[model samples]
Target: MSHSSTIARRTTPGRLRHCRTRSERGAATAEYAVTIVAACGLGGILVTLLKSDVMLNALKHLINYALKLAGVEGLEL
Candidate 1:
């Protein structure tokens, strides 16, 4: 038998390769759901950190320094 005949026989109908195609449906949707869940978890963590007192104080300090550089008086730092 030639190489082409062997290749064609392996890919014929009712083969294992054909069987796998049916089970591959909805695979993309499962992957999308996993990515969305991970993104939501990370966003929640970042929001909690940004809302903490230490982060807020650092932001306030940065704003005060910027205003002072621009020579605006009475920022109440």
Candidate 2:
């Protein structure tokens, strides 16, 4: 057979479909890995921010306001 015929046989419609499916088998795994990494990064950032004095103070102030609204006073969270 000629070289061109050999190449043509490898790229027929059925062969193309099988090749495409095999190549894409890891796509979902790659997507899940990326999502997990992104979630971890976001969690780290949130932990850092929540541990900061500003966020802590804001949270305390909100708690104090809520307590005052509930008829409790002079309590510091």
Candidate 3:
């Protein structure tokens, strides 16, 4: 056999040794992606709940201001 052919045969198995089948690898990437999405969704829900309280307070202040401008009485503060 030629020197180049023998070298090529020796290198073929080494190249294949570093490769992995899809099923043999663990599912760490998929698990991480799922955890991240769930955390983001939970955060979004918490922010939505908190935003309602802030919006309600702002509306109450606006209403109070309007009532005062109209010279209404009996509005406490």
Candidate 4:
């Protein structure tokens, strides 16, 4: 009901709003951590697959074909 009380109420809400905006930075950090873990998991799976003999043979054939097209003799992989 008083002038100072009214001013305090107005300023209190602004302070709370400012505090809310800072929390988004913490949320972004958490999201980045989760994303990195997921990406690492995906990369691990891909590396495992690529290291398999079948995937390596497939890639080797692809490279040999490309080299043949470029007039180089096919490579022994």
Candidate 5:
């Protein structure tokens, strides 16, 4: 075939695919970082909520209910 067609066949599609893959790979790193940050923020909020007196009481009640269902004595907490 022609010289230009030979060059296009060898280089163009491969280079385009490589460039797109590199850009998408960089975006994946940013996506992971944002996901980790959001997860950490959510975990912090959950920890704070669970430590509150209302949530503590609710958890204690739930535990006591489970114990009662299992025919065991409930905890005093």
Candidate 6:
């Protein structure tokens, strides 16, 4: 019984080593990381596009306010 237990322990380490040496484990992690990065990049692009219109409108308002403070009237261009 003791001999069988020792053999089992030795075989377990060998199996673990073999699994770690396989390429599939690292490949899967690499693929997942690439996919996450691509998704984040795409999301950032979309958010920027969506925010730009709002930002432009706000800037226009601020410029108009500054012009009013400077005593500039409309249609003076």
lDDT of each: 0.89, 0.92, 0.84, 0.87, 0.85, 0.80
lDDT of 5 by residue, 12-70 (tens): 76676666554476797799999999999999999999999999999998988888888
Instruction: Give candidate 6's root-mean-square deviation (CA, Å).
Output: 8.4
Model 4: lDDT of residue 38: 100
lDDT of 6 by residue, 1-77 (tens): 69999888878866876665555768878999999999999999987975897876876788888888899879221
Top-down lDDT ranking: 2, 1, 4, 5, 3, 6
Tens digits of per-residue lDDT for model 4, 1-77: 99999888878866876665654878978999999999999999999999999999999999888888888873655
For candidate 2, the lDDT comes to 0.92
Where does model 1 exceed 4 Å of error?
A: 1-20, 69-77
Off by over 4 Å in 2: 1-20
TM-score for candidate 6, residues paired by index: 0.41
Tens-digit per-residue lDDT, 17-59, candidate 2: 6664677889989999999999999999999999999999999
Q: Model 2: C-alpha RMSD to truth?
A: 7.1
List CA RMSD, all candidates: 6.0, 7.1, 9.5, 5.1, 3.5, 8.4
Residue pairs of candidate 1 with colliding backbone atoms: none
Model 5 residue runs over 4 Å out of place are 1-22
Candidate 1 global CA lDDT score: 0.89
Q: Candidate 3: deviation at residue 2, Å?
A: 33
Clashing pairs in 6: none
lDDT of 1 by residue, 10-59 (tens): 87876865465667898989999999999999999999999999999998
Q: lDDT per residue, candidate 3, 1-77, as tens digits?
A: 99999889877987879778788576778889999999999999988875897876877788888998899867943
Task: Estimate TM-scores for all models.
Answer: 0.58, 0.67, 0.40, 0.67, 0.69, 0.41
**Candidate 4 Cα lDDT to native:** 0.87
True lDDT of residue 2, candidate 5: 98
